[model samples]
Target: MPPRAIICPHCGKIIAGDESACSWCGTARSHPWWRLLKPTRDTARTDWVAPALLAANVVFFAVSLILNFVSHSGSILTPGNNVLLLLGASGTIPIDRYGRIWSLVSANYLHGGVLHLLFNMLALRQIGPWVVREFGASRMFVIYTVGGVFGYWVSYVAGVPLTVGASASLCGLIGALLYFGKNRGGNYGNAVYREVSGWVMSIFIFGIIVPGVNNWGHGGGLVGGIAMGMLLGYNEKRKETPVHRALALACGVITVAVLLRALYGVFPG
Candidate 1:
């Protein structure tokens, strides 16, 4: 049989089949036979923003469940409740007849049901990473929280009472992505912009069809996202430095603290 050439799996450098070491990466030829095959896929890069955002949503949902169980407040409505919140019939409202207004921020994280939470998280998973990758995590967080609060406030002003969910925030992420794509305007940027625009259109259409979708919140979020994107440059232009990282970490910690407090309020020892 002819002698076969051995390659370093890590560096792809050629070596004698009998060689036991990779001259380039210093990786020992532990399995020469396996090295003969094509290289394995590279590990996926980590994105701090996406995972942190997902964790926040999941933690909030869990805390909401605990609140439901302990307080029996009936404020935590789930999808099984039949889109009651979507119809604007029920859910937390910032303004009540007595002129109380505190739900503006709190409503951003509340969901009407399992499906409501699922859909928002799905959108976040789809769009959150792109926003983080383009705008840096710190700016993305600001866009999410601020845009969400702003979107809800707009809905409130529009007289859409008792609205709640992360859809508005996710829409903001999409809007930001759209702005980034259009403003950046390279091959990839334009492509992303077009694709996200399609998503925005689809979402708008869906909102029209769905009985309880908050069109006002969606529009407000989109506008907010574009504004924020313009104010904060893309990740390529603005590096995610130590300060940005610190801010993101701080936001994550605050989110956790808020959920903990809510849980404690519901289930005090």
Candidate 2:
């Protein structure tokens, strides 16, 4: 049997399979077991925004649960409205009565219950990566921040007293997918369109059946995402530009600032 030639990942040079090191690059070659465990360059290069967002949601849920348990022992997995509001639930009251408008972004990280958190996180895990791939990580963050704020803003204007969760942002991702499908135009594009359309239908149908579902936020997010997707363009249609990165930076800064303010208000000195 012949030994297969090994490729040097660092310098991208062919090396003798039996050699311990790459003489060309003066780098040590990885062991076969290590090579098997290591991720491909593409996978290693993948963006972290989606996972970061997911972690933020989980952290907020854990905090909310802890606070609730401290206040009332029986309220374990499901937190009460008081704790949720303290953690920054969005609504007319938080936006109007208290002037805590930052709740719009903060609320995106909060959830009503374990099931609510699970559902939104699952949807985000499914849809967020697609947006990151199509629009780039920076553009994905902008769409999520702007779309969620717009959705919550619409809900506040429509007089919703309270709402929380990442569904609005997930819906924004869906809208981006829809835009991609509609503009790309091909078998793959058609398939994307069909899949996203099914998601939209499922969301609306679920909203109708759920007693506390915020349909307004979901609709506004979809519209916001579509508009952002059109304006920003996707990777296939156009490359990510400086403008998209700048907008994403602005969105991130504003979101972070607002959340800090909300936290300060909650735990004043």
TM agreement with the true structure for every prediction = 0.70, 0.82
lDDT of each: 0.65, 0.80
Please state the error at residue 165 of candidate 2 in Å: 0.6
Badly placed stretches (over 4 Å) of model 1 are 1-44, 66-92, 97-102, 241-261
Candidate 1 weakest ten by summed lDDT? 35-44
**Span of ten consecutive residues with least summed lDDT in model 2:** 32-41
Give one digit per residue, the lDDT tens place, for model 1 in 1-269: 63467655434467676666666545566754323222222111444666767776666666666655555545555522222222222223426552334344455666776778888888777677667656766878878876776787788778886677888888788888888778766544666776788898898889989898899898988888888778766665666677666765675565556555444544479
On lDDT, the leading prediction is 2
The total number of steric clashes, by the backbone 3 Å criterion, in model 1 comes to 4
lDDT of 2 by residue, 204-239 (tens): 998999889999999988998999899889876687
- Which candidate's TM-score is highest? 2
| True lDDT of residue 129, candidate 1 | 64
